[model samples]
Target chain A: MIAIHGFSPSGNCHKLRMLLEPLGQPYDWVEVDSPNGATRTPEFLALNPNGKVPVLQLQDGRTLTESNAILYYLAQGTPFLAEDRWARAQTLSWMNFEQYSHEPYVAVARFIAGWTPLDSPRRAELPRLRERSHQALAVMERHLQSNDWFSAGAYGIADIALFAYTDVAEHGGVALAPYPALRAWLARVRATPGFVPLPEPDALAADRIAQTA
Target chain B: MIAIHGFSPSGNCHKLRMLLEPLGQPYDWVEVDSPNGATRTPEFLALNPNGKVPVLQLQDGRTLTESNAILYYLAQGTPFLAEDRWARAQTLSWMNFEQYSHEPYVAVARFIAGWTPLDSPRRAELPRLRERSHQALAVMERHLQSNDWFSAGAYGIADIALFAYTDVAEHGGVALAPYPALRAWLARVRATPGFVPLPEPDALAADRIAQTA
Candidate 1:
């Protein structure tokens, strides 16, 4: 069994769970709540010096960090990842887009709104984050207008990577009401085999997000 | 021949040039000055909505965006990319690390220093950027203490991805004097076959960086 160290509420961490559930891979979950200083602990740092989750530990005790990298590792040779060379590269392009273009704005906004205290200074960054978040969403909407999926003509890890944070963008004050095609694409991803939605934010996070909204 | 649209000074754009040079692939280079608003033009945006440089155009006219993705596409089946599944995943992990943890700090600091005026308000971000940039270098230093190369026991695309920004990090106000292992790794990368250093910053950029320094 694979051992995954992750925080349940984190989109980056949840990406592993969502992908593995569909792959039917049995794995153990070791919760490491980063926002509360769990990730800063020496034990977690020993697992990943970068101090991020989820870290994937193979049965042989070797570990891999970075959520999208973990997805790529686990999805290899499976239908979850593309087999064609160009298609695979395209998949990787979208994954990089998720990490660089999309997540930094969308996911960071969510972290600030939900995880931080109500009066946290990070909230000052919301306006810029929201604008960039919408820009990323616009790109996704444009792509979805012509293609039904982001993951190389199929629902795969690319979709999983984007969907993890995008589906909960509302918590970040990013509404999806304007993106009709993106909304439809989200539905298609939800209908994929063995699909499991990310757990709802905890009560504290939900309350903070509500107050911020 | 592949057609590459890139900014001459940007490390992300230069990653492709470094890799393709070593691989001995014939390619055309179209100068896209992203800092001068070239990427925002309709023609360039049509090619890549992300408005970033290092966009690779295939012979069939399909364009691939994101520098690391382009590297993976070009390096596939070459010795630069590993044949073993685990090693390849590890390579992808380091590439992802370069984009996520390293580039955002190191590369962005370089842009703020060189592209913006010396008195630009963005310069205020330098201290924070420097701190995070050092954190990223520390991670690389730790990894280098045990491994000679980043990708599957060989000098490959992962090293290229990191070296692009790290070699020029001093321009971003990040000194390598403290990181002996990382400095040694940089030297090793410089010695690799067919290696070409990143181009020096343009006159305007160099002047601004000098003023900031």
Candidate 2:
């Protein structure tokens, strides 16, 4: 049995749940909210000194942190992980892109608008964040215009990483309507067998989008 | 032939270079200085929508950006990438850690100290950068204390991703002396077969605690 400690609203956390659902793996859940600083507590800190959520306590009790890491763990050897060398490389390419390009912009923007108070000090960052974030989304939209998946022709960890934030990017004031291809890709991923919706409280909106064309 | 666009001083960029040296692969180097905004050039941005350094251009004209992605691409199907399932997950775990926890701190600190002047506007971010950067280093110190290598108990791309920034961490005004285990791990990586010294602007001063240890 594995244990996941993270808040449901978080894209990083949602990514783990997404992969776990597809893998049909059962794991205990412990919520660690970032705003409440649950991850900073001594016990959780011991597991991941970095103090971030989506830490997966493995079957052996050796804990692993980082959302993408957890996804890769569950997805490997399943139909989700690519078999070809270059295809596998492409899988990681999108994963890296999510971290470097997509997540910083799109996810941060969402957090600012959706989680933080309207008058919070973090609001000042919204303008630049929105600009940088949309720039990244446009990139994804362009890619999805031609390719159904981020890499190769299958759903994998790469899609899970990008989809978590991207599907609900509007919460950050990002208008996904402009990106038709990205919207189409989201539906395609949702249609994957054993696909799971994010466990977030207001996840209905995203789930509907995912299931719809 | 692959074309890699990156600045020599960048640790992430060097991650790709270090691995390439070991593989004996020849690649065309298109120098891109993010500090100078060279990556923002239209031609470069066309290849990489993110406009970041370390974009790998494949022979088929498809471009791959992000350092770890390139490393995975160039290293796939080899001993550099773990062949076993669990080992592969471990490798991804560390690599993802490099992105979320490690890079944002250590890599950012490096950019601030090395790329800009002490009094530059970007230096304003230093205080927070410093604390978070050390927090990340501390986690590494604890991990390196027991594990000889990350994932598969052998040297892999994770080490290369981590080593690039860690080896020259002092450049970012980050001190590595307190972390004995991490320091020793650096030494082991340095002594590994096919290790390539990072290209320095001049010569690397050998007097640092990181080198001396």
Q: Pairing residues by index, what is the TM-score of model 2?
A: 0.87
| Candidate 1 lDDT tens digits, A21-125 | 878889999988788899889988898999898899999989999999999999998998989989988999999999999999999999999999999999999
Local accuracy of candidate 2 as per-residue lDDT tens digits, A1-213? 889988888988989878888678899989877767888889988888778887888779887777876777777678887777778777887888898777888888777666655556877887787788788888888878778888567878888889998887877777888888989999988898877776554554344333322
lDDT (0 to 1) per candidate: 0.92, 0.79
Interface RMSD of each candidate, angstroms, one decimal: 0.6, 1.6
Q: Count clashing residue pairs in model 1.
A: 0
TM-score of chain A of each: 0.98, 0.90
Interface residue Cα RMSD of candidate 2 after superposition: 1.6
Estimated TM-score for each candidate: 0.99, 0.87
lDDT of 1: 0.92
DockQ of each: 0.90, 0.62
Ten consecutive residues with minimal summed lDDT in candidate 2 chain B? B204-213
Q: Which stretches of candidate 2 lie over 4 Å from their true place?
A: A117-119, A199-213, B117-119, B202-213
